[model samples]
Target: MIQMPLQDMIKKITDGAGISEQEVNDKIKQKLEQLSGLISKEGAAHIISNELGVKLIPETTGRLEIKNILMGMRDVEVVGKVTHNFGIREFKTDNREGKVANIIIADETGSIRIVCWGDQADKTSDLNPGDIVKISSGYVRSNQERNEIHMNDRSVLEKNPEGITIDIGPSAASRKKIEELAENEGNAELLGTIVQVFDPKFFEVCPECNKRAKPTESGAYSCPQHGDVTPNYSYLLTAYLDDGTGNIQAVFFRNLVESLLGKNAEEILSYKDNPSAIEQIKTDLLGNMIKVTGRVNKNTMFERLEFVVQSVDPNPNPDDELKLLEKEKQSVEAQAVTEEVQ
Candidate 1:
């Protein structure tokens, strides 16, 4: 007989309703199989934690007591005040329909939005905003914005009413520097703050557009529906240093955003399906502190230096860049000192 966690049981019940005891058992079996697929490593870790009587909480939910949580995990216990809850509602789409809830929770670490489902929705409703609660088995899922964590039914909630404890960590990752990162090729890590920003403009078409836009008599440009055309410019710049044999500065352009945030780019391109959207994004990329991991190659169109950014932090902030820059400065100074001593 498998002793399933209450949170897991709640997920099984909420995911599929109006079930019988035998069905629940079957669901448990299926859940175990599914869990094996989704959480083999985490399950093993949980088993060991259980044997050791260790508690785990999601990184965003708890106080500083349980700060060592790993990344990309589920099932953490946290104690926090219920800042708010938005009840439940139907979320309809061409593909499917379901329910979702929004709640605000906070501990010493910080605050974030949490979403509840099914029974978890009801459980959330019972508690008034500002009431402190001790939540067990609360799992973290990315919010609709894909930027932060939200909770769901696979999690458990209890009204603490008193004070609750939670764990905390750095709200974001630190980024490197450009001067330090301008070395060689290979997998590089860099972090820097955005020191500059450029404006965005509109575009019509180039010779590249086989159909859409056409050239104007004034040597400007024009499109079919978009009319006498101008390109849209948007820039997003961040600083990063690649930690290869030596540090190397890295930068990303429109192509990198197309790779990392294609969905958003697609939305902008929906009306025209032209190069204007990409140009807009690039123009808007200035003064945005960024950490990029990619290669350093000479800009064929420019000078002896250029950075081809690969992946970047979609959600970056000021403090993260400051800390990373400080660390890199220290490392560089240390290396310089050593060379002088030698």
Candidate 2:
């Protein structure tokens, strides 16, 4: 039921297939008339694009701002700087193999993750942090509570195209109180005190596939992808964060947890059986003011909003914050004095 604009669909068809705009328009009109209300205009455009071997960019031109992207939108275009690029990783299934890469792209409005699949993943190999790129014919989908743009075979990747200039800079993450957090608001930054640190635990993962390993009756762990194999350890940390307005549960994965704890998974795993060591670690994290950045999503398991922490800053400077608070307090007192004088 997703619909793209008619003009965008036409442009995609012509540009992708190297056909004239008139030719694509004629074919689209023919398809619409032949279908005779059986399909919508966007649907007919898709059909025409498929028949002509044109990769239709979803419903938008590449000029749409990052903040305006939404779920279920097709052929969305965006231009932004690459803030973080996780190099390509390969995977295999029973029948085939493929590669995928993920990079965080940011504009002045905000940031979103771009997932490039198959050969398109290779196309992004030369991209580095601070490189401005344009994504064309990409599709939008909501992963958890994050808006993600995915590039398929038909998607276009343009690096620093002429005549287009984006002022490259760090994407600003909006500061939100715990109570103000909403699902699918893109990326967010929150400042809160860690009210509680749940017990940290390590989960066994498949060495080959990196998915959680399943325990078998034979006292060995099995991975669905690679069968029986020696498992690797991955950390999962859960905690509650509270600002004055409200409290929310936050989850951190291996890398973020390592950064916050100042230790790697192996070092923490060494103390797994030592209850006192684990308790000491948890105690250290409690009552600390930290800033966390990540996507907010509905945790189906808990049936509530949960934050998936991507990055954490344990020691952000508070001088500016204190000055701002002082300025606000002084303004309030000045207003009260003015009222008394009146």
Candidate 3:
């Protein structure tokens, strides 16, 4: 069974059924009343999708394009040219240890993050830039708001696969002002100043799988797959970024967290034991200019929109900023003139 976020499910339904989001919500509410609130909103939406003849998952036998792959899809297959290799990271848990490899691949449509785990990660070492790879039996997972094709134990990885060629292109992210960002918009680039920064929050996860672990009946935390284990710690950092147009809430995960703070993983994770250690870092980030590319997600729990950053550049080119400034100025002047003519 495919488990996707409720908002994402609603998005697919509204797009497929040619209906407004409000109409879909009204129907879901009606369904809840009819069923005495027995079923979940997601289940109601799924039923509505089926009744409208809107298929949530595409039915096909061939490989999919990167753009067509959605979060929560399973048994996915895609072939693309490897654009970059991020190298492999190894982690250990009480029960087992494994490696994770992150690679960026692109097709004519767009690029995506392919995360290989365990044995599949080893295969990535043989891959190089411009090499073609075919991924089979992969699962699509949403990290923050971006969809990544994850290959686990049941997945297949083929390097320099025959009969495969992809016309790779530059990243498809749209460079937009903070004010111009829209919910569900993926691969967006924002150049802005750090208006505000929050103290980092640390959390525990299963080291082997890197999923959230919870307390068991006993005192120790346990992973559903890894059983009772010593958990590894990770941190989350959030800040408000402002370009001249507006400000947006931006979130940075583990990999980019170190880059943002100019600290190594150990130094950042050390804050878990001493919570007060991050005050200096938090103070340093304020008022700094940075460039970020990420996906904008409607933060349902917080009831606001947020940018889940995938990449960060602490020092961006000033010339590029000047060009954008001029472009924005012209756009504003053109808009004012059009308004006057109207």
Candidate 4:
């Protein structure tokens, strides 16, 4: 039996497979150590990644698969167009006394914060808010609040000269057939990366029907469709979402606004600098799997289909569904009591 160092075993495993070195050294240390006892010293020295079936990827690494990227991974390169730039922040490192720049980048898959060091930050300057980028050799890292990617010395990025490509994965937009969506009664799974969120403005429209709001003489707005009604100005986000099947504009109604910001739609739309609000809205919708229940509105001018959302539930979070069930139960019980009284 040959003797092998644990470090060597980690290297061998990560090198053969697309797994990250951090996975063998940090996350799977205990598992590797335990497996070490079972194998001969020589065998342990050459732990194969294929033995694990799947690679241990880092968090926030952009990849070909948006779902996998959102969930976190070892390393991945994703291509996306920057929908908005929220500026960059500088943070100082205690040990090195050096600063790093942090910026958020979004693809049709989702949005993740990228940390740039030294020349990388400067190189990214040419990449503006709407330009496309191919982030290469990126690794995922999770913080206390969320998962993000580090674009430090180890990472590399390239601009996409061919324009932003529209290929998400199998679970992404291509699967949502418009014909099927029209026939389905309940929620339809929709895939898209949100590109924009329009800020709300003062307008009058029918409360029931969201037609173009009209202005009247009393320094107020009125909806002509609904006669003699008070004007309501609500913050509703208008997002450009690309689902590969086609790029369409969508209105994420009210609940999605509350779920994302812990605030109502009215609050989100009223902000003066709407770019920040747009960023938050994008984070909540992009890359995240969603089941959008709404009717399709065909845009004659844009030749695109829009989902005027009735309800949106993040597929990754099951608690929202559970809450809906609980509410339904309470409603049914209350209705039963009312019927008995009648």
Identify the candidate with maximal TM-score: 3
lDDT, candidate 2, 235-266, per-residue tens = 78899999889989899998888888889777
Ranking by lDDT: 3, 2, 4, 1
**Candidate 1 Cα lDDT to native:** 0.51
Identify the superior model by TM-score, candidate 1 or candidate 2. Answer: 2
Q: Assess each prediction's global lDDT (C-alpha) against the native.
A: 0.51, 0.83, 0.87, 0.56
Worst 10 residues of 3 by lDDT: 163-172
RMSD score of candidate 4 (Å): 17.9
- Write one digit per residue (lDDT tens) for candidate 3, span 128-242: 9889989999999987677899998999988877777787555577799889886656689999899899888888899999988898788899999999889998888999999
| Residue-by-residue lDDT tens digits, candidate 1, 1-342 | 123344554344434454454554554456557666665433543443343343443226542222232234456665666656657876788997777676666666555556676666666767776677766665544432222234565567677645544443323322333554332232455554443332222334433332346667987667665666564433333333333333333455555544434445445445244545555554445444455666555443555454567677755676865785688789999999999997
Question: How much does candidate 1 score in TM-score?
Answer: 0.29
* Superposed model 2: Cα runs more than 4 Å off: 1-170, 323-342
**Could you tally the backbone clashes for each prediction?**
47, 5, 0, 7
The lDDT of model 2 is 0.83
**TM-scores, all models, native as reference:** 0.29, 0.48, 0.53, 0.33
**Is candidate 1 or 3 superior in lDDT?**
3
Off by over 4 Å in 1: 1-77, 81-89, 93-96, 102-114, 122-131, 137-156, 163-342
